[model samples]
Target chain A: MTDTTVKEPVQFFVTEDPHHHDGDHGEHHHETGTMLGFWIYLMSDCLIFGILFAVYAVLGGNYAAGPAPVDLFELDMILVSTFMLLFSSITYGFAVLRMDRNDLKGTLLWLVITGGFGVAFLYLEVLEFSHLIHLGATPQASAFLSSFFFLVGTHGMHVLGGSIWLVVLLIQLSQRGLTHENKRRVMCLSLFWHFLDLIWIGVFSLVYLTGVLL
Target chain B: MSDHAKGGHGSLKSYLIGFVLSVILTVIPFWVVMGEPLDNKGVAVAIIFILGGAQMLVHIHYFLHVTIKAEQGWQAMSMGLTILLLVIVLSGSIWVMFNLEENMMPAHEQIERVRNLP
Candidate 1:
């Protein structure tokens, strides 16, 4: 019995050390946790967007004789803005690739380009909104306009928040040079940026393209 | 450290593939709408929705890097649950509201009959 006990402790010692080392070296504990947490947050954000989409879907037909979607939505300009967002999504992907390679300068450059595209998207959106208001299709004009503005405006606000986060991350990256915390931040922001692009797919498809078609 | 870290992110080739697919997907819908090649509006709208959903899956795969293996499958699990809930919320609200509108709102003739009840 004593011999078996001694051998068992020896076996446990051998297995425990490698297992501990593997856990420490293979991945950072907090990094995985942070990523999972951020992902959960994004899923919750998705629910909010789902609600807004429902609101728009239900109320989109009540134009109150003010103006229909085709009359207000300029497909040409919207297509341009859609390209801006798609380009930004790719550029942000490039940035994440650069980060993976530890290419600091390349990552920053791609991020800057991504930011430029994001700004262009926002500018186009603001132009569209102002033009709509000028044309007297204000939110108060009809339930359709109200829901349209709310859904699309909420998406724009998310993009705006992401842009701000990107700027902050850029500054942090420049100062810290991709430390562990900065790397995690970059990864989270990457998720946010890409998620926004995903949401844009819905917006352009359902709100803009279908709106015009309807 | 970098090697293991790189596992989670996509390579340049993958990103390029996704970008190209996305561009094609996006362009087709815009073209269909602007060019009006499809005479049937319903068919055109269906095409737009299908392509848009395809593009969204592409983004989720390529950009988000979500997989059954990611985060020991927790990511995929959470995403699945969220999608289920999203579908329920969106479809439920539309269905209920549409039914409510249909049943509750009186027809013009019915309203006139009620007014003439005196």
Candidate 2:
């Protein structure tokens, strides 16, 4: 070999396991990363709800010449709404199960049912709020009403958002089929749906049920 | 395969269990409040709160799949931190507010008596 080109040792990056795909298994789909990010988001969401709850607790008993919880809260109405949401959460679980099984049609069917229940829940809440407002118990009526409206209204908004997400997801599921990315989206939405249900539990217990009791 | 190995993600059995428990917990409190099963308001409040707490655990465990095992304990860690913050925020707010109300707001009867005196 001609020694005319005496070159310095070439510097380049090297690795013993450069081609190892062990860590890059199914995780390349960004499933774990998205899940962790979503979880952090949910925790922050929890803080928001927590503060709202604290506000409700603080201002709950402040009638200020306005309607009290017992006067405004209808046990029957809230009970029905509670079941609507609880059922929706379970239906969402069914949808996720269908996703796990790669049954796109079944998933959509269950998601529709879940959305139906969500709509029913929001309807009941809207009706309750409207009835209260008609009876001169608007949020502007008193501190108690203000906190009640804000806390429950925030939760209702979340459900509305989830319902809209459900419609969009149904569209996505139809167009894209049950791809890995779609499945991850389903799981994330499922987490969100159930998280809302958890917060509702606190609301009904602390705000409504306990409110009437107190 | 990983999904299959990890328990509580989408199990039908767990969902059913959670649903049933949630319904019972909800119904019992409603009954206690509506029917006034116990004459004591405090007892009814205590029962409702306890059952409510249990039902929340059920939802967290089964529906949300928040177990000690999920995500290599990340779920539990985050959940624990959230619970701690919630307790602090909720209890602190309630305590401060209750004290504020006591110190600031007069009872209706006291107000009425003051009105008559003036």
Candidate 3:
């Protein structure tokens, strides 16, 4: 039939894939494109963190006569926090793997575990900061302290954000049983959790390690 | 399914390496700052500084996977720009501050307060 003669239009099939044509396997939802969009958002998040790291590096070592990284860091506790955050990132990876398998319960369990560890890490970090303040290393005291706060504080905030993300994913997983959207959300959270772990490494290296040396 | 194959030991192995490197980096720097003189070392702190930067790359590439993808090239470009700006701000300010200290501090009583200490 000629294109002009077709009454229903040439693109009348409603979707590119046969599985989605009748809306059976698709159940009126699509995720492939959405995942790409989330990936874009992840890239943008990279830029945000780039700016923060620059701020921290520039401000680092402006110690203004207060306690510096050398005097402030306690290697033991930071080592523990590092383990928690890194492990949480790995567990979140496992969670997403389970999600891909359609094991909703397993995914939820792993995500909750990841979130719990993340919260624990944040708690310890707050306590560490409190102790630092007690010893007179407040952010306002010096440029070095300011940079230290921004660097570590930004990581702490990302952990908090990841914890909230896992919580929401839990709610969705329970309510929807690993629907496509929920799975995509879990994958995105995994990337974000791992991203925070990556930042923690930089913190461990630049701020904690280098600060102590300087 | 791609999902079932996703769980593996490789990711965990990388994580462990990253952790150990992090610990070593932390310890050496801490020791140096706490008053072990680096004067006698043949290489000085130069080796440690290079190691630390390399360790940072390990975390970024192995864990983050951000790179020069066609779609995500902005991330790398932005990161490079940020690094350039960071170096300028940090080094320039530090240089200015050191010069300021030498030229200006002797003009004030702050120096006298310390000199008069019993």
Q: Which candidate leads the pack in DockQ?
A: 1
lDDT of 1 by residue, A1-214 (tens): 2222233333311221233224534335445677899999999999998898889988988889889988888889988998898899889888887877779999899999999999999999999999999999899999999999998999999999999999998998897675555667888988988898899899889888888887
Give one digit per residue, the lDDT tens place, for model 2 in B1-118: 2442235475788889889999999899999998887889999989989998999899888888887776667778988999899999999999998898797889999889989994
Query: Which regions of candidate 1 are displaced past 4 Å?
Result: A1-27, B1-4, B108-118
Candidate 2 reaches a DockQ of 0.47
* Candidate 1, lDDT over the whole model: 0.85
Clashing pairs in 1: none
Evaluation by TM-score, superior candidate among 1 and 3 = 1
Scanning candidate 2 chain A in windows of ten residues, the lowest lDDT window is A1-10
For candidate 2, write residues A87-157 as lDDT tens digits: 99999989988776778889999999999999999999999988998999998899899999999999999
Ranking the candidates on DockQ from highest down gives 1, 2, 3
Backbone clashes (count) for model 1: 0
Model 2: residues >4 Å from true position, as ranges?
A1-29, B4-8, B105-118
Residue A14's lDDT within candidate 2 is 40
Residues A1-214, candidate 3, lDDT per residue (tens digit)?
1211232233422433334334543422333344445555655665566566666665675677777776789876877897798678667766765665668788888888888899999999999999988987888899878777876887788788888877877886787675444555666676677767766766766666556555
Model 1 lDDT at residue B51: 100
TM-score of 2: 0.87
Sorted by lDDT, highest first, which candidate order results?
1, 2, 3
Give the TM-scores of the predictions, in the order they appear: 0.88, 0.87, 0.67
